[model samples]
Target: MSTFDDLDAFVATRRQAGLALSPDGARLVTTVAELAPDGTKPVTSLWEVDPTGEAPARRLTRSAAGESAAAFAPDGDLLFTSRRPDPTVEAGDDEPAALWVLPRHGGEARQILAPGDGITSFEVARDAGHVVVTTTVPVGPAPEPPEGTQDTDEAPDAAAALRAARKKAGVSARLHDRFPVRFWDHDLGPGRPQIRVHDQLAADRLTEPVAVVDPAGPTERVRESAISPDGTRLAVAVDVRDPGGASGATGDRGDPAAVRVRLELRPTGGGETEVVADEAGADHEMPVVTPDGRWLLWIREEHAAPGRAPAQSLQARELAGGGTRTVVEAGRWAIRSVTGAADPDVVLVVADEQGHAPVFRVSVADGSVTRLTASGAYGDVVASPEGGAVYAMRATMDAPPVPVRLDPHTADQEPAVLRGATEIDDVPGTLTEVHATAEDGTPLRAWLALPAGASERSPAPLLLWVHGGPYMSWNAWSWRWCPWLMVAQGYAVLLPDPRLSTGYGRGFTDPATGAWGGLPYTDLMTVTDAALERPDLDASRTAAMGGSFGGYMANWIAGHTDRFDAIVTHASIWHLDGFVGTTDGSYHWVRQWGDPITDRDRYDEHSPHRFAAAITTPMLVIHGDKDYRVPIGEGLRLWYDLQRHGVESQFLYFPDENHWVLKPGDAKLWYRTVFAFLAHHVLGEKWERPALV
Candidate 1:
């Protein structure tokens, strides 16, 4: 069987991410993740693809520790980061990742910038080759430098030594005087991110690093950044807390204040900082400086409120103190990333639009927008310095991400696929579109994947797979919530983009902002019913499954309807009131759902936990202990509620995993368990527990 037909093979399939274009646009490189020799974890390696699509793609760098964040310096040298041990120093397992450079003329890769704690990410200036890097530093004052050099700034290695001393003393405590003490899956404690500049970058070494944007409090950090083509100015998006706290009474929940991301422009060589964009209730990020250094491009998103979804648009400002203009109007689409185009007046903008994340060329001069690609989701875009071909990674439901070259001048043009590090020769199913109108006359659509042998005479069992983010779409390929795996097992998977999903304009997403179980839930059901009418699907033996927000809907559907034979929810919310207070981003959710204490109407009406007694369908609940976003408490409460109500159910728990089961072995088990559950309840097969449970 092929990879899609076997869970083991699927886990071993090589996955690719990150794309880098050489300065002259002669070479393209990306990092590919593959299972390690021990078969315990995945390691990444850099691979180079020919820009002209003439020669086959080949490996560029390899190491057990792996390499990532690849970028090309102006001198043609390739730069990357890896945790590989430095040959010149004695390495330990705790050694952090360091920056390395591969010579342009083809030679051995050398470690150039190996700070004590190591670098997190770095960007290379297009023209000057200067490097700007972000790294973590201890929150406390730096230990004093050796007495002789008191006049000079603290030694570069002082902070590293202090960190080591703390480790030696077994001090692993983190004290936070802010709202969010944690992030997605990890604690945001003892150290914060700091930006540093390196003016001298050599083939074999780098000059001393200078602190640029140092955070004064734990609440401050850089959101996004970009360096100008001339390497003289650095644009950064910084997150800072507002002096006034939340709009309503915070009630001593450790809530500091509302946070806003501001755009700032600072000189590279230590000078005054200029606040370019600082709106009161909005965030500005994803900075991209035009090739000629004439215009600065970034995304602005207003804060979301009850019944009012966050509106996003692209902003372009003249670097010479001229006024800023909205290049892409609000409610048009949710912009993802912006890249400088070959033409100085034009910039490439990628946004979700009608079930696809396509590239759009926006004229920075006139605020005009033109679609460039016809279909497929695109990301990591780069344009040739001489205004030639534009390169990006594109993916569709039927295919994984692959490098593609696009034309900057053409509108809705087909992208030319370039040879990538890995390829899938076959997919186990066929993909087609499913459309339906909501009860309110709003349009709804979905992508249906049918098994290879599905037909009217031999229909495939159905699985309605709702996407997460209630705010995101099922447009691109996702290795995590893949549908091909289900289709390979003789099932038709329905991938729906309901009202809450992006790409359909703000009108589609607005109604779902505060009313989670209202329009979005009904839209999902409407699309599923439309798909069930197909002759190639067996509607009677259907199951429903989803993760995150989709999981919340699965719970809602279980309480409201019993059309499906079984339901599977992963990393979901059970109670809106409890979820808002405990989630990492509590303030953000509070704005959307209202205060659970004072404004309790929405919580009482929409929370799925309140309807647990009404559910009759068999359920398989899944959650990870490390999932701070959804929290494992939701899963435990759901399991207990199911048992108390005498509902047939099973709990799949991951103590070491997060919101997503990312480990190879755990991900394989996740699929096996879900398939087994569906096979028994939906296919009328005897229940058989997964092995190694």
Candidate 2:
């Protein structure tokens, strides 16, 4: 059996993700994560892959603190962010992640920039070596304020000093006047996100940082940004709260106060910023400057309403004062990213189509779209500076992400995979698509992973694995919600893309917008029934598992049906009314289901907790206290409801983890516990608790 069957071995397997191509397209850099010695954390290191696929990949960097966000400088030097201690500077425990550069000619990697609180993300100019970095700066009033006034005019240049003073004085409170006081796992704090520019960077030291996009408060944040090829201008996507609501009302029904990501153009050197796109009810994000620096391209998505789902389109504007044009129409496919091509006339766009996220070339003059890659999902796309080839990290359900080279002109091309650090010899199962029809005659499809060697006489138990981001699809490989582990245990894992899933056009998602337990649930069931029709799958023995929105579906399944022998829900929302008000993005949820107070019928009908008394299946509830997206209260309340109703259930809680179990040790335990619970309920084995639980 492969490591996928063993929790410890699976956790130890080296994981490869992210890709960066050199300016000449001769070298490819990828980040490989390997379990640390303590087996608690996964440490990442940089590796170089030959773009030609002739040379075996070689390790480029190794450090205890790890390195990531790799990008290439205009001069071919490799730049990455790391928390590794600098040799020249005195080491400190509070050292943040700093920018480091590895010379292309050779020699040691030198620390270039180390600022307080470190950098989160950065971009390098293609024609110029200018660097733009995204970091956090301290905000809010000092410890003791006079009267009722605050230090609103605090200088951003003295942010480090202010932060140090606050820390030294043991004042850790953040007074927030925004709609959202917290995010996914952490509170919106004493510091907010800001972008800085480094016009001059050296090997020995970093230049004094110049704040370019300093937001007003914790509410506003830089969502995405890109630097021009000439390094003269910067395109940034900043998220800000809507003044009133989308319809200019006081956030009543049909109108909700939402935080939208708006596009802005600013000079690399300090100057007035220009608002490029700030339409109401829509978000403009993922700005990418064309290679020739003539056009700026980005994705514009409208906010979802009651019966309507969000619509996205690829939009472009001429940098030198021209009207914006729609390069691609809305509802064609869910656009993931846009990469500048060597020829600015044609850009490479990666989008979710059917079951795969393939690369497509779109004409800038016209909106003609052409598929480039045949299969698999791609990320970190880098076009060749000279124009023949494109490089990206490609991954399928059966394979982890690997560096691959693509032919820009070829359609449906099977890209040649470049040898990298992570490699898989064999998988525990085989992936096949299962198709069926919903009760309404709608076509439904799912990816089913069947374990090796299972006949009609000896069928494998089935596990229905629903994905989160009801808006997302099961098109790419996911480290957190992998199905291979369950497949390795002689169980068939069925990954379904239901009504709310992307890649199936816009109409498919509209049916499940405010109706969580309606079409999406039926679509899942329809696909699950199709998978069970196979002779190798045992329909009599089945289980359901999901996290986040998928977890909400799992809870819904538990109450609505008894088809499954066991259910596992992680970070699930039990009560709709409770969740919408408590979630990090309440405004977004309100847009979908409307006001829980005014729209009581919808909440009462769709809420999973309302039907909790009907659940008869054994369930394992898992939650992390730091998860503000779904919140731990939902899990605790669900556990209480299940126990009070005399339903067979167990709660697995993590105080340190967030929505996902990220730590290697914690992830191992999560799988072990799931495996044990399923073995007992679905396979009719004795109840055995996981060790260290």
Candidate 3:
């Protein structure tokens, strides 16, 4: 079989993530997930890439469990977390992840910190030897921090000991004092996620850890935390919900599950942390301090609701306690991420622009946003400490993400691509930007890919591939949802940013804020219709497919119209009323959707199930049992709905998967089944099921 046609080669494609620059700006590190020699599972390991684009990338660590969350310590040591056991120092091969440090000069990686509860993630202080670690511990009384050993596999904490005891007793019951008892796929009861501060005592061991910011109302999970360069101040995002104790029976305004997450700035020494940035109906997260420690910059996200439009703006405040001000509100585009630069006058930012995720340098002095990269998706941007160049993972429709270094002033002028990473089969297609006007006269756009062989003589089949995260723009290189895959099957894929999509200014999204079924759905159809006008696209043979929010739209399309030959929905929301409560966080959707009990109009009007009886086209319903965001109940209910309605449908269920199909074999089967289904419906070919499935 050809390389592109082989499932193993497709799965072996480069999977790179998490880029970090050394303090001296000489060396760089990134984690890549590659198939092991045994070809059983994907393993993540640290790779040292040349920041100057002068040399080939080299592997830094090797292990079955692999390494992750790497950061350069102040002393030039590479700090990372791994589950691999220490060779000289006895440790469990499949044990919980522990912090390991590799010397700057080339030596063996030594186990530094191994807490009993185990560390999920860790961040090294830029100037200080302190380290901030996030871990899950038993919710019982506090115990003395036992001295952890570098050369031993012993866990020195009471929490870990109690957990073992509970398992031995076969006690699985968990008492919940909060609204969300479960997250994406796992129950949150056995242990609660907490942030603890620890110091690197020496080269081999770490000091005792201490819980600093445990709130009183409800248990909070620290999603992301950043420490100041000097290690004096810590900015953290604590995800918590308001467990209502108001006057009403069901609590304030009949919504007991309302939640709000805030970013707090506090001294690293564990004192009262001030709420640096908090909006009534918004979320503040990923607070990063400037290199000079003068400002704490954070991304503010306004929730979209019935009358209000969603917005993402970069806001900054004086580190000495001052009111926050909008830094780049004029841009209108949602800022993806912001990284502080050595130059205090400017900070590097990444945001969606039209159909591309480009790098932007926002000047703090006048709040001017400057486009750095011309046109492509860029993320994991880090400014050099020496103030020379900016480094990021650049990806486009034509290529996957590759580490690149760009001139600080004119990044797009001559961005140097760093090599030594695995390459993939060059996508055999032509990528073009296309636009259309919505019903309300709002201009919408999408990135369309047409197969190289497409022609008017034998036009390729059209596939309206809707992107997930209805709010997120389809800009980056996505191995999971590459349009090239379908293009390889002689199909043209239309990736539209219908509505509520970031980029293209605020006016493009505000109109369809909470009204999902209104303009956004039409915008999608509008773009799809416009793309079909191309001579190389055969609109008569077309299909529509999406996942998550896109899946919701696919379900909506199945119910509203029968324009396409078939519809494929994965991890979709079938029943709106049951979904809002059963989802990972109800409060997030409740603000926009309102309570299903009180404000039933939007839920009833926007829900796909309300119009399921009108579906006439064949559909393939795909979902994973482990998906807690849109639980298995949704797919099960959706399948039964179609069966009862006597609609032509097929079900693709994954028992061991989550919202995303991550395994190599599973993903191969997914693409195979999807193509086979499309072939039967769109191409009018005999249905030939995937060999393995």
Candidate 4:
């Protein structure tokens, strides 16, 4: 651990093993970014590797500008969205993201659409003829011009006259002003784009698309859409509210109202949609139709009471008969993903149970499931087309991700190291499971990373890392860069999945339900106290850190306790009252907080801002300026308040980053800043002061 290198080499080595293999298992696409010579901004590129070894790996798209959401068409052609360097539109205006297609073999890339169309996402049809593009269209007529349009004294100016005429005709003056704009806005907005079957083969095709599913009404908020294997049905997962009203509730756990998904049958010939399967209350996900088109398999998250794990049930519906049956019951844990195997009667399901996400096969007939892979590392498992072999991505904390092939028939589950061949060799430290007792004496699971030279006599500085989601968990596996970097610098790391973390029964995560600042915060205190009890940890020099919900905890901890010498909070919510008003999902937060306007005392009392004056620990706040979730304004308010209260605080803002720092250079810089802050405050190391701006 003491021999760890700089952040650049570390990230590069880590990324080597992070490439995603295509479904065909022939091509690999991964994001790569290089630091500009001046080290200001990153120049990003998406590279491809041919697993067949027939051609050398090549860079498909290169630009100083950032790009993401890259994927491959069914034919292995590259399709990605990119923001062009030169914008033809005015600043602060929407510069439409253009979709580009590049041949796998390599050739000139072609831009499919121009700017101003507001194309968000496009998926090629199974036949590869036409792509179903999602864009926003005006809902209603735009605002009209000034009242008095025709004036003889005005001399009928051409531009003004044209504008006046258009306004009189009910035309919108600005693009965004047009109503009923429907685009593929992911995870945001009142309405999302529905999956429309488009025909590329048609010669007289206009951009106008026939709506396969109407998302205009209150019954739908399409989160994601997937087409059937035979392309005959569309599965849409939406969080539907009440008709003509909002689904209001207390708590961020989404609307307490029932959740349902509709499996609509789409005939090749245009016709009305037929509902194949419909279920209510449970949160449904990963709706995949079997290859034979007889059954549709999906993962359903069954809602739990205030203190229980959301039960994950695997279910399948007979497409033709319109009857549904459970393949797996609502277990203590949740399922991740499911896919149709070559065996039409069986489906592959991935679930996280007891801190590990494993793959299993479930029979469509009797609902019996067989575990395929038991390793709980955070990785992906894919079933082969033949259903005999399974390919997986295995990751550990210290090691990069590797591809593992499993043959259930042979009972072989060995993994082949795919990436980071030269890196992560002889990684120091061992992973150990530790448990802490919550307020009610319930056991909370956690992972502890011992320093390379850890011993009772030479206790190492402890870095307590809290996970986000208040619902997410910290599992064993490849070491993350931040914690590993700290460990390499001679600090021990303790990651606790306190109450409210997933994987455990819903009861564990329910502690944070309506008691955001109550039981959950107590759970953190319990974990931290347990960490301090370890003889291998230096309790006097402890530091705490987390992001998102975890970030909120870090801020709360700093304000409440003087136990930690330093703290780092990222994308954290400092004030629940402000968060409910400023965040993109303010409604969700309001629901979580039990009505911000009505329950002002509950919101304010739970917020870290209320306790800011009690903070004695030097803190570092890292946030993304463009983050809509727990916006940068939240961080700014915290920093300004902390400064006003005479607490030593530092704030770092990544201008172009969103909720998560995706760019390589920014990530490296972020790690560097965190390391510097921790080293100076916790380890008493000399470091340059961070540039606050």
Q: Which residue pairs collide in model 1, if any?
A: none
In the range 266-320, model 4's lDDT, one tens digit per residue, is 5534666665445543466666767566777777765433334456777778766
Per-residue lDDT of 649 in model 3: 89
Task: Work out the TM-score per prediction.
Answer: 0.96, 0.95, 0.94, 0.79
What residue runs in model 1 are displaced by over 4 Å at the alpha carbon?
141-156, 216-218, 243-255
What is candidate 3's TM-score against the reference?
0.94
Question: Model 2: runs farther than 4 Å from truth?
Answer: 141-157, 209-211, 216-219, 243-257
Worst window of 10 by summed lDDT in candidate 3: 242-251
Error of 4 at 462 (Å): 0.4
Q: Which stretches of candidate 3 lie over 4 Å from their true place?
A: 1-3, 88-90, 141-156, 219-221, 243-254, 411-414
lDDT of each: 0.86, 0.86, 0.81, 0.64
Q: Model 3's lDDT to the true fold?
A: 0.81
Local accuracy of candidate 3 as per-residue lDDT tens digits, 400-485: 88998887788455478997466777787889978888776778888888888889998999999888876788887788887787
**Model 4 alpha-carbon miss at residue 261, Å:** 6.1
The residue pairs that clash in candidate 2, if any, are none
Query: Tens-digit lDDT track for model 1 on 1-693?
Result: 888888877878888888998888888999999999988789999999888887888999888999999999998999999999888878887769899999889988989987666788899888888898888777776666556765544554767767877887898888777768778899885777778878776456888764477754557788667988777889998988853434333466523556878899988777788999987668888888888888888888887877778889888888767788998888788888889988878988888988899999988778788899999999999999889889999999889998899988899999888888776657898999999999889988999999999999999999999889867899999888889999888999999998878899888988888888899888888998899898989988999999999899999999999999999999999988888888888888876777778778978889999999999999999999999999889999999999999999999999999999999999999999999999999999999999999
- TM for candidate 1 is 0.96
